[model samples]
Target: MINNRYDFIMLFDVENGNPNGDPDAGNTPRIDAESGYGYITDVCLKRKIRNYVELVKEGEKGYRILIKADRALNSKFDEAYEAENLKKGQKGKNTDDVNKAREYMCKNYFDVRAFGAVMSTGDNPCGIVRGPVQINFSRSISPINIQDVTITRQARTTGDRMETGSTEMGKKSIIPYALYRAEGYVSAALANKVTDLSEGDLELLWTAIINMFEEDHSAARGKMCMRKLIVFKHDNVLGNCPSHILFDKIKVKEVSAPPRCFSDYSITIDADLPSGVELIEKI
Candidate 1:
C-alpha cells in the first residue's frame, strides 16, 4: 500500500477537436468566456479515466465500476446490504448498514475507491465516501478559438433523400489547438480510512491517464494526446509542503504566439530541495 502523499500535474493537448462540450450551450466547447480559455470538467476527465481502467482491468477482481452506464444504483446498494445480512439505514446516527454497504462498494469497485461517490441517493442510502485521490478541472494555458462547422448526412431517418433531394444538416464544434493542465492530489491517510490503494493501483492510474485518449476516438475529438505528467511525492503520510507552493514550481512559459502545437510552450521545473520530497515524471 502507498504510505506517502502525492501531487501531480498533467499536460495534454487537442488539435482540431472539442475536448469537452457544454450541453447548456448547444454542445459547444466549454470555455472561460472572459479569458477565452477552454476547460474540461472533472466529471468528463474522470469518465475517460474510468473507461481506461475498465478496458485494462476488465476481468480482474475488485475492478467493477460502481458508476457504470447500465448499472442501477439503488439495486447495487440493496445488493450490498443483502451481502452483509443488513438493510438500509435512514440517514441518521444509526448508519451501520450504510457503512457496511459503503465498505462493500469500496472493496469491489475501483472508481468508488479511487474517485469516491455519493451513495446516499434515492432510497438505498449507502452514505458518502471521500476518496483519497482528487483531480481538478483541466484548463488551457492559452486562449482557444472554437470553430463551429455545419455537417451533412447523406441519408435521412424517416424519408428517402431521393424525394427531398437534400441531405440532413447538423452542427459540430472543434478547437484549433489547446494545451490543458490539470492537477491532482492523493492522501495516504485518507486511503487508510477505507481503501488499500496499493502500488499496483497507483501504477494502473498512471497507465490510464497516459492512455486515456488512445481508445476514445470520435469525429468531434481529433488528435488528442497527453504531453507530460509530473508527480511530486512527499515522504510523510501527511505532506511536506502546501500544494499551492509545490504547484508554483512547475511553470508553463509561453514561447510562441498563436500556438498551434505543444512545441510552442515550454514546461520548466524549479530545482529547490523541499526536504523529504521526491519528483517523478511519468511522461
Candidate 2:
C-alpha cells in the first residue's frame, strides 16, 4: 500500500536503442544489439506510481502524471560579463569604470563540466541520476487524466573516437543499464489520523489505475521490468496522506545463465549428471 506523498522514478536501461535518433543519420529510435532495455527503470518508477494512487483512493479521481523532461544548462558562459560601477579613483569618482567578469562568474553553482556530459553519445551516453520530482496532494488536487509516462533514454550524440586523446575521454553518458534501488514513504495525515481510505482501499484503487496502462502483458513486462516491487513510508510529512515512490535498485542475489544441468542424484545410480554443474547439493 502507498500513502499521500510520493516520488516517481524513471530509469532507462538502454542497451542500443534511441527513440530520438539523430536527424542527420536517420530520425527514429535506433535499435541495435547495443540498445539496452527500459524494464528496470520503468518498473522502479511504476511501483511508486502504483502506491501513490492506491493510497489516495479519492485522490485518484484527480490523479494525473506529468513528466518534466531534462532541462539543459546554458552554454554561453565563457564570455565576459560587464557591469557599471562608480569607483573612487585618484582622478575622481568615475562612473564609466566597467569591469569584466568571467562568463561563469555570475553563477558559481553551475557545473562547468556538465555540458560535456550532454555531448557524449553512441554506445555510452550520459547517465541521468537526476533526483526525482516530489508531488503532493495539494499540487495534484485538481482532477486530471491519468497518463502513463515512458521515458525513453536516448543518446544525443555519438561518443568521440578513441583517438580523440585522453583529455577527450568522457564518461559514457549513455548507459545501457543502471542499478537502481527502490524506496518510499507515507505522510502523517493518512498515517496518524483516520481517513476513509484504508490500505486495502488504496491497493484496489491503484490496481485499476495501473491496469489502464498495463493492458498488454508484454508491454507491462517490458515496462515494469521483472515485475518486482519494494515500498516504504514516512510520518509527520508535509502532506496528510501516505506517499509512494518507485525504486530501481533491486538486485538478484545471484544470477546464472545458459546450459542447464542435472544433479548426480539422478533416478538411476548409473545415470550421469548433466554438464555445467558447478556443484550439487543433496537432501
Candidate 3:
C-alpha cells in the first residue's frame, strides 16, 4: 500500500488535432474566454487514462473500469450487493451492506479507486468513496488557432436521395499545435481507506499517463505525445509542503514564435527541495 504523498506535473502536446473539443461550441476546441489559452478538462484526461488502463489490464482481477461506455452502472451496483447476497427491498442491512459494497467496488475498479465514485444511486446504495488521486484541468501554454475545414462525401448515406450526384458535407476542427500542462496529487492516507493501492498500480498509472494518446488517435486527434512527467514525493503522508510551491519549481521558458512542436520551448526544474521530499522524473 502507498505510504507517501505524491504530486506531479504532466506535459503533453498535440499537433493538427483537437485534444478536447467543446461540443457546445460546434465541436470546436475548448478555450479560456479571458486568456484565450486552450483548455482540456480534467474529465477528458481522466477518461483517456481509464481507457488506457482498461486496454492493458483487460480481464485482470480487480481491474475493471467503473465508468465505461454503454454499460448500465446500476447493474454494477447490483452485482456488488449480490456478491454479499444483499437482496433488493432489504432494510436495516444498509450500514454494513453499503460499506461492503463500496469496498468491493473500490477494490475492483481502477477509476473508482483513483478518481472516486458516487455509488449511492439505483437499486443498491453503495456508499461514496473519496478517491486518493486528483487531477487539475490541463491548459496550453499559449493561445491556439483553430483550423476549421469542410469536406464532402461523394455518395449520400440516405437511400432516399433525389439527385443523381448528391453529396454530404461535414466539418472538421483542429489546432495546428499546442503544449499543455496538468498537475495532480495522490494521498496514501485516502487510498488506504477503502482499496489497497499497490506500487504496481502506481507504475501502471504512469504507464497509462505516458501512453494514453498512442492508441487514442482518430480523425480529430492526429498526433499527441507525453513530453514530460515530473513528480515530487513527500516523506510524510500528510505532505511536506503545499502543491503550488512544489509545482513552481518546474519552469518552462517562452517560445520565439507560435509553438508548433515540443522543441519550441525549454523546460527546467530548479528543485531546492525540502528535507523530506524527493523528485522523480518518470517520462
Candidate 4:
C-alpha cells in the first residue's frame, strides 16, 4: 500500500445577506442597506441548495478515506480486520460513520460554510459592496504506510499422538504481528478529482473538503456565491493544497464588508447537486 501523508487546504468567499437572521425581528436582511426583499429569486435558492449537496457528498468521501487510513494504522484494529474469521467488510462502515461525525463537528464549530445570510443594519445598506465570505479547510494525515510490524503471541495449540511430526508441529508458536498496512492517501488530490468543483479555485477546493462531511448541497452553493467556503492544507491534485498541517487550528473569516453591495452576481455552479435547486428571492 502507498504509505504517505496527505495534507490539503482550500479557501474562498461568496456573497451574503438574506436568510442570515430572523427577518421578522424588526431587522430586515439587507445587502448594502437595501432592505425590503433581496433579488435572489426562488430559482436561485433551489440552485444554491443543489450545489451544496454535491459539495457535501464529495467532502464526506475524502474524510472517510482519511479515517480508514487511521484505523489501518492501529495494530489491534488491523489484526481484527485481517483475522481469519472476520467478515469482508469490517472496518469500512465503522470508520466511515466515525469520520462523518468528526467532519460534522468541525464544520459546525468552525462555521466553514456560511448557512444563513447576515444583513447590515446601519444606513446605506445597499450602498456598500459586500464581498464574499471567506472559508478555509485543512487536513493532514501522517505516518500512512504499509509496514511489516511484528506482534508477539503465546502458543495455545495442542497436538494428538497421531499427528506424527515435529513436537512443535501442532503447537502454536509465538508469532509476531505481520500484516499489510493499507495506508490511505486522501487529500484534495483525490477529493477534487472525484468531485465536480464549481467556482473560485480556492472555494472549489474548500467545497471538496466539506464533501468530507455531511451531504449538504447548500454548503457547496455557499462556496460558489462567495458566501460559504472550505479550506485545507493544499491542493495535492494540482499541487494547489496549502503547506500547513494545522488546518483545523486556523480561524474562519467573517464578512467584513457591507452587505447591500453584494448584489446578484453570476457564479459557476456545480452540475452535480440536486436537480431543482435554483436561485431564489428572499421574499
Error of 4 at 30 (Å): 18
Candidate 3: residue 25 Cα off by (Å): 0.3
Model 4 segments more than 4 A misplaced: 17-207, 210-283
Once fitted onto the true fold, the runs of candidate 1 whose alpha carbons sit more than 4 angstroms away are 88-94, 160-162
Tens digit of per-residue lDDT, candidate 1, span 1-283: 7888999999999999899999999889999989898999988888998999999899888998888778788888877877878755554245777788788888888998888888887565778988888999999999888988888887776656557765778788999889999999988888876666677788888898999999898878988998998899999889999888889999997799888998999988987949998989999
What is the lDDT of every predicted structure here? 0.86, 0.26, 0.87, 0.27
Top lDDT model:
3
Measured against the true structure, the TM-scores of the candidates, in listed sequence, are: 0.94, 0.24, 0.95, 0.19
Better candidate number, 2 or 4, judged by TM-score: 2
Q: Which stretches of candidate 3 lie over 4 Å from their true place?
A: 90-93, 160-166
How well is each residue in 55-140 modelled by candidate 2, as lDDT tens digits? Answer: 44333432322221234222221111212222322122221221122112212211111111121112211222122222221111
In terms of TM-score, the best-performing candidate is 3
**Model 2 segments more than 4 A misplaced:** 1-61, 64-181, 189-201, 204-213, 216-226, 232-251, 257-283
| 1 versus 3: better TM-score goes to | 3
| C-alpha RMSD of each candidate structure in angstroms | 1.8, 20.6, 1.6, 27.6
lDDT order, best first, reads 3, 1, 4, 2
142, model 3: CA deviation in Å? 0.5
